[model samples]
Target: MQPLLYNMPTLFAALGIRLKQISRIRQETDDSKPHVVELQQVTAVQVLVKAGQHIRGEPVEDRINSEEVRRLLDEFVPEWEVREERLYRRFETANWRVTLMTANAIGFLSEAAYHHPRLVLNYRSVEVYLTTHDAGGLTKLDFSLARKIEETVGWPRSREEMPGRRPKEWLRS
Candidate 1:
């Protein structure tokens, strides 16, 4: 049997599809954190967020040991809660709770969701966990957010003590 021109075009389309294969997500390295996330053209860095335990992941180690981490935390992150949602504390825009209702962290979690879409957020006694379903583990996004949370809440002691962490600044947030 002979194929028609229309059939010829369809065959070519099929060939194109067959020629392409989806990319896979892979771990990141050399970032000093010792772990990273890169998948299907997406890039993410994994940072460990812990409350107690003193230590675990390499990121935590770096943060404590690295003078850079110390400076960023000391200089950038406000020691007290800010009135806005500018990474210091939860405010009108920076409020994650509200963001959760509206999924404001959508872009934040997009990459994690793309690869392992399944995420389980557990607010434990001391800390919260954000893990990826596809990766079957937690990624840097989780830790980064956790660190943000710590900063947002004024250094992780408690909401009450947050104000004491730093001096009052009307324009802080």
Candidate 2:
């Protein structure tokens, strides 16, 4: 009799299949209802997987401290803020459409990176706060995501304009 030895790829494939089935079950249960709980769980799992891969050879104590964060911000993301354990930025647009577009860009980037941030969307402003809650502070992931967001949506150059006017011309460019 031979003992079973699971391969990493095989294990991952099996886990992926199980996750798909769970997702399908959630979808089949209710089409109209928002599966917020399930979505959050899946997102969290994805973030964990990504973070695990990212920190495979690194220690959690390597998380960026306030001084390091400030230095990094000064070099690349000067407009961003560091408060306590979080990195924050606010962007304003001229109209609701642009605001929504900016928010969607941030959402897409965050999802792809598996590093979600807190985004508050006002009528013409979007506030983003990034932190590695698991690490209990800022990490390389936070800065990476913030840089992506800055590149994707850019900083607002002017104040909010009329309701229908697009204030941030660079967003269109």
Candidate 3:
């Protein structure tokens, strides 16, 4: 057999099937073209939702409406904004080390969730742009990942009086 070769995630997403979680990924052999031997799927997570939120379109996995997006931003992720139909957030760090750390943290979260975002890192800041590209706009996945990112990365600065050596000026905005 000529090895099963194709972009599985892209193909499945193009067909309206969202792969929510991935436990791990390991290569089976060390060759010029390494084969992905393991791909594990996990369960879904709960996210904030307003009652009677109408989800339109053929597939329920399609893009979320602007009104709902507005509500989600206002209620859940106030720091994030909608730009050109993508969920956006900018973290202003203290210096280069903080900037790189923030970017890498986001990259780790994005990978674990299997919902990647476009990250732009600078000397003192990192910009995150998220969207369900295959679904064509923002969706539950985007919101969930954003929430996770905030909880993990934003916690140090968000808490009123966190113990330990958490830097006070680690992140801003």
Candidate 4:
């Protein structure tokens, strides 16, 4: 059996057939079985590092070009601006309390996505700047995370109604 199996590959190659193609055809015949399954799982940090390497090594085709960036700004996130290959947005709240709440929410979203952005917190506002430093410009990750941040914070809301703000009782000294 071992010799036959070893000779099978050589026989297929001699006949101008590919072993991979034969295996794929066999897999297709078995409709009850899954062709792919989850293998070993790694931490989010590892995934981010791999993604950064891929972006750096490959062409910028995956990155959002300037034209699409401008279109996205005009259509969805008008408040966001493009400058020097970065997407910038500033959100104004009614007070410092609201600013903190928004900032925390943005931070959480950034961590969850594994894509960090530059955030500047002010007395009543927060400025967010996003760009793919590895790609040297904007990428879909930046825009997607920005949209998530906007949705998470519900920007432009007043201080009294900012999302994720704890009540006075929940506050610690």
Q: Quick one: best TM-score, which candidate?
A: 3
Backbone collision tally, model 1: 5
Please provide, for model 2 over 1-173, each residue's C-alpha lDDT reduced to its tens digit, 9 standing for 90 to 100.
Answer: 11113222233232221233222112345457443212223332354445443444454535776788888889767779886568899887657877776786677557656566899999878999998766888877787778767755664343352234544443422
TM-score of candidate 4 relative to the true fold:
0.54
Work out the TM-score per prediction: 0.23, 0.58, 0.61, 0.54
Model 3 over residues 74-138: C-alpha lDDT tens digits? 88788789887899988877688778767766775575555668999899889999987768888
lDDT of 2 at 60: 53
Per-candidate local distance difference test: 0.30, 0.60, 0.63, 0.58
Q: Each prediction's Cα RMSD?
A: 18.5, 11.8, 9.3, 17.5
lDDT of 1 by residue, 47-157 (tens): 222222212222221113234434544554434222221222232222333233212232233333332222232221112233333333333333354454443322324
Q: Which numbered prediction scores highest in lDDT against the true structure?
A: 3
Instruction: After the best TM-score superposition of candidate 1, give how far the Cα of residue 139 lies from its true spot, in angstroms.
Output: 15
Off by over 4 Å in 1: 1-39, 44-70, 79-88, 94-98, 101-173
Q: What is the alpha-carbon lDDT for the whole of candidate 2?
A: 0.60
Tell me which of candidates 1 and 2 scores higher on lDDT: 2
Misplaced by over 4 Å in model 3 are 1-60, 158-169
Model 2 regions more than 4 Å off? 1-61, 155-173
Q: Model 3: C-alpha RMSD to truth?
A: 9.3
Q: Per model, how many backbone clashes are there? A: 5, 0, 0, 0
Give the local distance difference test score of model 1: 0.30
Ranking by TM-score: 3, 2, 4, 1
lDDT of 4 at 16: 28
